[model samples]
Target: MDTALQTKPCRFGDKNTSDIVICLKNREGIPKRFYSHSSVLINKSKYFANRLSHPGSNNCIDIYCSEVNYDHHVNLLRLLDLPTDSILDSFDSVKSAVGILQLAVFFQCEEIACCCIQYLEAVPWEDKEEELILKAVSKLGPKAMPILARIQPVDLAATKDVFISAVRIATSIAGPCPPFGNELKTSAQEQVEFMLGEDEDAPLVTADEEVKSVLRMGLSQIYSSFEKELSSLLLEPDLVSERAEEKILHSLCDLEWMCNILGKMDLMKDFVSNWAESSSNVLGVVENNKLDSFMWGLKIKLIEITAKVLEAVGYGNVILPTPIRLTLLKTWLPYIRKMKPLLDSKGSQETGFPYKMSEDLCQSIEGAMVTLVLALPSNDQADILADWMGAEQVRYPDLSEAFEVWCFRTKSAKRRLVEGLDGAGNATVSL
Candidate 1:
């Protein structure tokens, strides 16, 4: 056979061609033996070099390994005898590379260890494998930096720069989504969420002041574009154009996406405030226009956004000036009430409405509306409840809680006034 075609290229375990006996001492089984050259062992491994350098000549060196590590050690021993170019071909997976790296580190074999590091640095790792690599490489000295580079903390300025760029793309105020724009924007949105995720691990990036500032700027840009779109629609004739609806709907969708990101960062107050200021105008445009039945989806989206805003305000997550708060409630409550039955009627048709209102969302809106109405001053509460009582669809908002409270307070009003006067008299005498 030609030398190139010989199967035993390394001639590693062939006793006929070997000069030294290498012993593999396993924890439980009989020690295994491998045939090797002293020159090869000394040249390939520093550990073997130091061990075989005793004052008296010895033809044997023993390597100890646990049962779990026996295969790795055997493979590594075979690798030591492999041609330098063929070394990487032996260990294929991340687990094998990591195992060999641990042994290479112990054997003080720089060549094999360097190859392992290169392989790990270039390959993608699964989640658990990443953890394993981190743990294994963490114990190694500065030589392992290549493997850690992917997980290391990036410079703060660079991180912020990338985030701001993504925000600009995601919240771009330009007209309807460009070619592949939705996909690109969706990707950007996902990255933003991932960076700020708190589900499994801590957030990759902290939403510090700088990050918040970028987000707020993006939010403002989108809202400004949205308001302008709404204002233009108000001035236009009641004729419904697909182009116009697309423009308005696109902006609303962007705002909805922003709501989710801001909610995660606890920055809902900015959104709630902006929505409060814009609520009257938003509802005004909708009421003025005669939208086609297909436009019912727009109303559902508005309710979804309004539901989030009401939840924030009603639960006091976002506090606002009393007038703004009252305006917000007044603007959205009637719109929601008006749209509910309309949407239900449309949904009941044979064709069926594509956008069905979420029952949970309706419940959330009603609950928030009740909490919000009750929190208002007595006069405001009376105005809201009186309006609710006269509405055709009083059955849904079910403001019985606010109604009952208002009734009790009104009934005891005279008695409370008498007690207040009596308390004032007693305080004056005591003084």
Candidate 2:
């Protein structure tokens, strides 16, 4: 019997054994227990195997202890078991610190994760070893959620590229299906939104004189370039004669151009407020019969433009002025209420742009109205208007005094009837 253990030539400690082969052999019937004196050799085999199998494993601390030779593992584990204060003062490298973090997180190490996150947060973005930081974060999982939440938009803006790079590293370490995946997704979206000027309703800078000066200079240059074309468009005789929808569309284009030229200035709030004040003056020029029709569509377009501008500026709660809001309510809503019957009566094919246009106009108007109402001061008039319009009063109960004034201005117009009367002496309305 050949009892002289016919073992395969063991390159047990050889770094050139190709880590994959070591792992495969370890899995192929290695005894679970070995002599204490042989632990050094046994552990080296296991370490080589694990490293080969998980080459991309980023958690250095975990990998170090589980895969290193027995004496090295004991030494590192002893260092990790030191008092928290001492551990803070003495770590050889980020890799070693990260290893400790991995061990802590794997064992539900709350205090360890907390301390690591604090240290990692304080590390300068440029100086910190990104791979080690990401590995620590990946292992922290939901424990990292609060730390992530505390990251300020301003800080993120400064280190955006670095942050994105770290995010990719962390995702790779945590694997494709991470437990805290949604948290990462939310953070990414928020960062993008912030960068695109979606975090606030006002412009990025308000009182910065340098920014304002540059803005004014840019606006003057743009106005100089496009003034002639814009004037020609406005002065064309066909503008007044065109269908109200066409005219309103052109006006919307003009507004967009103005917004662009101003470099979408922070002063947009003031500009829009002033524009709203002047809308009544513009409305005065149209003939009475055409005025209602023109305003009906114009108000809807105005609302759409308001929403677009507000969204662009990042002011989620900015409202159109009361005059514009009233114009929408009095001119557009009643028309839509009347037109709904016509839309129902005619088959979809027979309903031309007038019907389809009116529906789109109403939807945009309603959307703007909701936005405006949300920003108004809480009051009875706002409540009444919201309720009359069949809006949910609880969500937006406030109505500004400006809106009330608008309601007063448009009250007679909304209630007015045409000359001809039915048997009840009320004017026969058309869709």
TM-score of candidate 2 against the unseen true structure: 0.30
Which residue pairs come into collision in candidate 2? 61-99, 200-314, 200-315, 201-314, 201-315, 378-398
Among these predicted structures, which one has the highest TM-score? 1
Listed in order, each prediction's TM-score against the native is 0.81, 0.30
Q: Each candidate: what lDDT?
A: 0.82, 0.43
Error of 1 at 410 (Å): 2.5
Residue 71 lDDT in model 2?
37
Q: What's the distance in Å from true for residue 226, model 1?
A: 2.6
Stretches of candidate 1 above 4 Å error?
A: 1-16, 21-34, 50-71, 83-93, 155-157, 173-180, 199-209, 228-247, 264-266, 350-354, 421-431
RMSD score of candidate 2 (Å): 17.8
lDDT of 2 by residue, 1-431 (tens): 02221232223333332122112112233322111112222232343334435657431212322342333333333333344575455554555556666655654445555666665555554335665566567656676764455442454334544444333322222233366664664454344335335344543333245444543443343333333333344345554565634644544444554454333345465445444454444334432343444333454444445444434322343355554554534443333344344344453645453433344544444555445544444453456465555743222212344366657645644455332233358646889
Q: Which ten residues in a row have the lowest lDDT in candidate 2?
A: 17-26
